[model samples]
Target chain A: MSATAPRPNGAPPGAVAAARRYGEVVAPYLVLAAVWQLAALAFPSYLFPPLDAVLARFFAIVTSAKQFTDVLATLWRILAGLAGAFLIGGVIAFVMAQSRTMDRFLAPILTFFQGIPALSWVVFAIIWIHGIELRIFVIMVMTTLPAFTFQILGALRAISKDLFEMVLSFRPTRWGRFRVMVLPSILPDILTAWKVNLGNASRVVVVAELVGATGGIGYELLQQQQLFDMTGALAWTLQLVFFVLLVQRLLAWIETHAFRYRAASEHSL
Target chain B: MTAGPGRLEEPVVRFDRVTKLFERPGEGTFRAVDDLSLEIHAGTRVALLGKTGCGKSTMFNMIAGLLDPTEGTVTVNGRDPFREFDSFRGKLAVVFQNDRLLPWRTAIGNVEIGLEMLGLAPQERHDMAQRWLTQLGLGGHENDYPHALSGGMRQRVSIARAFATNAGLLLCDEPFSALDEITGQRLREEFVSLVREKRKTAVFITHSINEAFQIGDRIVVLKRPARIAYDVKISPDLDAAEKEAIRARILDELSA
Candidate 1:
């Protein structure tokens, strides 16, 4: 019962444990950085820039107003597209879960869409859509919708029948069943879906921008390549990698807090 | 019998010729409960003794309003529980074999779930859940999640959840069989005292003869297909030897 009892002084056991877990996570990245620096020393500046040079260029891009706008613009497109996919795909997934007939009808279509690559969608969007922003947004949604829908559907199906029976024994109203049972049960799955789609959204947006857009980091990367500014191109690529990692870390933090109950309960055992 | 206040003379639960059929893939229908008939009066505690797959759970589900009888009827408080399902809202609660506590919710949060479904105000529900957890010797662990607690502690939270609803009837399906003998015995004692204090009518299913004798004022043994093998009323004044004799008789019926 005193599994969670705090010590008389200093940090709680839970906090200390979390800190150690985070340290384990960061340790690999440090090793990767060391390897990258070693590899950079063996290569010429034109082909492979040193880590410090890339970092310096990354800082310059981040500090400049015009380049920063490009970064923000790409981030906005990815987020807006993700939001739309989540809303539309969530409803579709819910409908599919509730009715067998609907699920049967829609399963094939979603499967087909899932099989189609992000590059194909970007190509299709370029040919069909007029505006660069709209094209990029459409491509991101196209690439992410099926994944989100299917992942959410899988989560819905995985819910325990025992939990459902326990809730039904209470004789809750329809809304009450959804609020008290359905929603909470699927929340962890929803976070997982978001984590997956976050990577997908960022990847597809960059591809779309690289192929069709006049603005954003992808566009800047193409411009740098055409001007033979490999250093600038490498810098933008490094910035892109950092952005992805930052977003992933932020999401991981959210996931940790959101499912902290799971960690707490599991550790107590 | 130590009946609670305002105990009614009429039965609170009555199963008349109830039968349940389940369809197995590639096989024909299987009869889980076959023409079962029983009556449990208000404020009385009954233990249903049955082996695995003897349809104890099927019967328990019928009483809880989760399944309909393939034949005959099941009535709770004089209403058909399946047909009048909503009418039984807040009237009954169940403690399952496993704790079945929501892993996401804290111990007190799990306890307050029924109250939430009953539309009790958040503050009131929180306070009531806290009091119940305290009563169950889990005061400081209210904020802990189900995973954090031991199996016994989780089961206690589950019992508290059922009791906090203040339901007129409690249905327990081998609620303590998972625990060790000592913890199960301790919890059973705590549970029986709480049920007596609340004056709630309870039907508990157990395979153990000792558990039935320990918990029930009346014991109904069920054979496969769910017909009653033995129906006996237990007297509180029975001596240890008399209790042993009853246990032997129930064991014979169970084995037979």
Candidate 2:
């Protein structure tokens, strides 16, 4: 057949076409069901709760006002932390790019902070601010700064010396260079760093809250665990995972649409 | 002072006994430039022909003030370029072989960058940018990004950008080296017309002997550890056939 020739419905009809496609799609689920059945046969009830029990727990968490409130509180804290981190870390990264002395001075300190786990900072943050909000500040400073600095520095280094000469020849002012050259050229690296740090920040937020929060998803998980209800703890953990996945999907959408022009600009550079 | 502008018009660019050296591992020094001297008059187009690492780029860099000569002084438009970098930068534009258009900017955006550097008003910079883009036959491609354009088109944008700056000296280091023969030839013709119209003095470096013959008003050939081996001035009146003959003759002399 000619490559250009169009098929009638974009795919060939077959004996399979007469069958229900939805049932065909669920064939994989049938295999999964058989595996679950075998597991139920082999394993004890406590270790492996039936899929129905897990589904029931999922529905309960979704319908619970307290669970939803707890999740909202955690989400709010994460958003506040991310906002603060984006601004503070972005400025510091820019400063690092401009001056070698500043970069040298801060490099070791940042590396040291990044090497330590989020849990290590929780005690100090509580001592300093004595509240849940303090963890957001600590998380922003620790998780975001190092990634942001490294991303900006990496982008700066990846630029061609010849391209800089071309800029010099054009004689752009400091502002012009920033707007026309620096912002666009280093955008992809900066975005990648932001995405990486977003995940880092989210994970750290949970750790910080779980260790010390009074009223958030982590706090709820802690309370449930203290009450000896493993199902509630697992449900909260699943919710956190779902939230992270949702944010990632949202970021992907923004990158593809909202920031696409900036991405396009960087692609050529 | 009256005699031929008393070296005032003596030469727009001059290299006075310039020497450039680099150090090698377990070696004292590598002499890239050796007390080389030459004079190029205002509006003169000089082509420096040499093999790779023969110091053609180094010499050009010295003239462009990208590097200082190890020993002798170099001057452009009667000013020592190193003394005031900004002043020198104001009048000198370099076109590298890699058409380094700021990838972030559109074609006209790249062209207008010099005006922004000079602190020109936005309207005037935009107007000048538009005019130059049109002049270089890039009228339709002004808004196109560098990635969206072909190599020859990007080179054309580079040319437009270099010319738009109104620099007295244009230092081109194999600007067309990346292009195929046909595009290179067309660009050379376009370049000749553009330079003639702008009345800009230029020093072009190229490995292609034929390209030097086609675009140059004068040519300087260099051997390794370079000194100018031959200086030839072509008659401006020469037709294409005669220019081709001149190229063949110059190649034969260089090979010998």
Candidate 3:
């Protein structure tokens, strides 16, 4: 819901404001599409296919089960990796936040992960696990650790000592402190971190599938490229981009509502 | 219900030779608060006046149990406040300079947080928040975000939040310093009336002599480094003319 009101328990008062915000966002897409169509007319058809061709390919991918299955596979791998990362990386980040020694120990490891390319992990995965799922796992370990650890660390650091004092002073049960203070304070940052991870993850999935997958959009694209079907390759690439955009839009909706609820609750106080 | 709700006669927070020190790894020690001693009796409204960095906030922080004195102890109702942070919080409500309301929670929710932490039922907490919001001239604006509220209105919300818990000691650190002078005056009057209505003890730390005169039962001025230079009991029954004279005297003391 659009919670534009300042306080929590009170009713909201600004539907007009929300409508304006949506209008501001949707207006730009029309401008972008016009610009893209105009640019397509200038570029060689090989490098930049007509916008209609890309849209047609995107529609076909959306309609087909094969494309859906490939997309789902990539999503599943990312989700599994990220879930594990939150567990492992969250604990590590928390420990690092609490102790200087732990921070010192983990900082270099995280830096190394962020600095290295995801493709390198795919090579290692081939040597170690020698399979597509293993390659996906490698991508997960590489992308998930950096995003999860840094986001969590950033969240922890962003929380004010005043809030900590408030938690400590209230002497709420450990669970209550986490529920009331730590979770709310860190959520926006964690959500932002997830968005960053998704971008990386989509890229990682493409690399993983291109190098090792038996079936997937990236594998399909690689095959088309091998056969010198530039139209099919570009078509597959555009579909993948559209999928990433859809995920981003979904995350945006979730964050806006969640933040509004939180903001309303705070405003009431 | 009768007003001045929890007015009591005994001291609730006692700072006995509370000395707070800070030292960097290679630097000499800096005495933030030096051998500071004070007592806040219930129902008495006192102001701690000092220039910035004169240790007013440090003293309040120690009372709030956010800091531990390097030497001596802070006893809230004969118990070390730092020993049990939760219990200390229960007995004390603080309004910081920055109005440390949770940015995510609304005004009512902010007011109800302590009650929520106390584990009061959610509906009852909502009722209490509503009552306070209305009383603080924020009846219709309960759902307004902090950013949406004017500076003066936000202070009112903060005051309401502190008073809602009915804590024995209310520690306010320059809460109105950021406000315009006229609004600040109105808030001071409102605050004094609120304290009188609630009968709660308060430690209002501010640099404004006008504000000190407006709400303070007792004004304690701190000079540089952290010593209470002047302790004066303001007359509770000063008329407009008498208030002007008192204001002049207080300003003279401040300038000196």
Query: Which candidate has the highest TM-score of all?
Result: 1
lDDT of 3 by residue, A62-116 (tens): 7888786876676677677766677788888899999999899889989988887
Candidate-wise lDDT, in order: 0.89, 0.78, 0.78
Colliding residue pairs in candidate 1: A265-B147, A265-B148
Tell me the lDDT of model 3 at A167. Answer: 51
Off by over 4 Å in 3: A1-67, A130-134, A160-174, A226-235, A259-269, B1-10, B228-232, B235-256
Judge candidate 3 at residue B200 and give its lDDT.
Answer: 84
Q: Sorted by TM-score, highest first, which candidate order results?
A: 1, 3, 2
What digit string (tens of lDDT, one per residue) describes model 1 on residues A1-269? 39667654678779878888998989998898788778778877776667788779899989999998999898899889988888888899999999999999999999999999999998899899999888888888888899889888988898899998898999999999998888888887787887788887877777888879999988888898888877788888776677778888888888788788876435565
Residues B99-212 of candidate 2: C-alpha lDDT, one tens digit per residue:
898765788888887777777798998899999888878888888878888899989888887887799889999999899889988988999888888888899999988788
| Clash number by candidate, in order | 2, 2, 27
Kindly report the docking quality category of candidate 2: acceptable
Q: Write down the DockQ of candidate 2.
A: 0.31
Model 2 ranges with Cα > 4 A deviation: A1-112, A127-132, A173-176, A215-217, A220-250, A257-269, B1-7, B237-253
Number of the candidate with higher DockQ, 1 or 3: 1
Chain A TM-score vs. truth, each candidate? 0.85, 0.75, 0.80
Each model's DockQ score? 0.65, 0.31, 0.22
- Best model number under lDDT: 1
Candidate 1 at B195: error in angstroms? 0.6
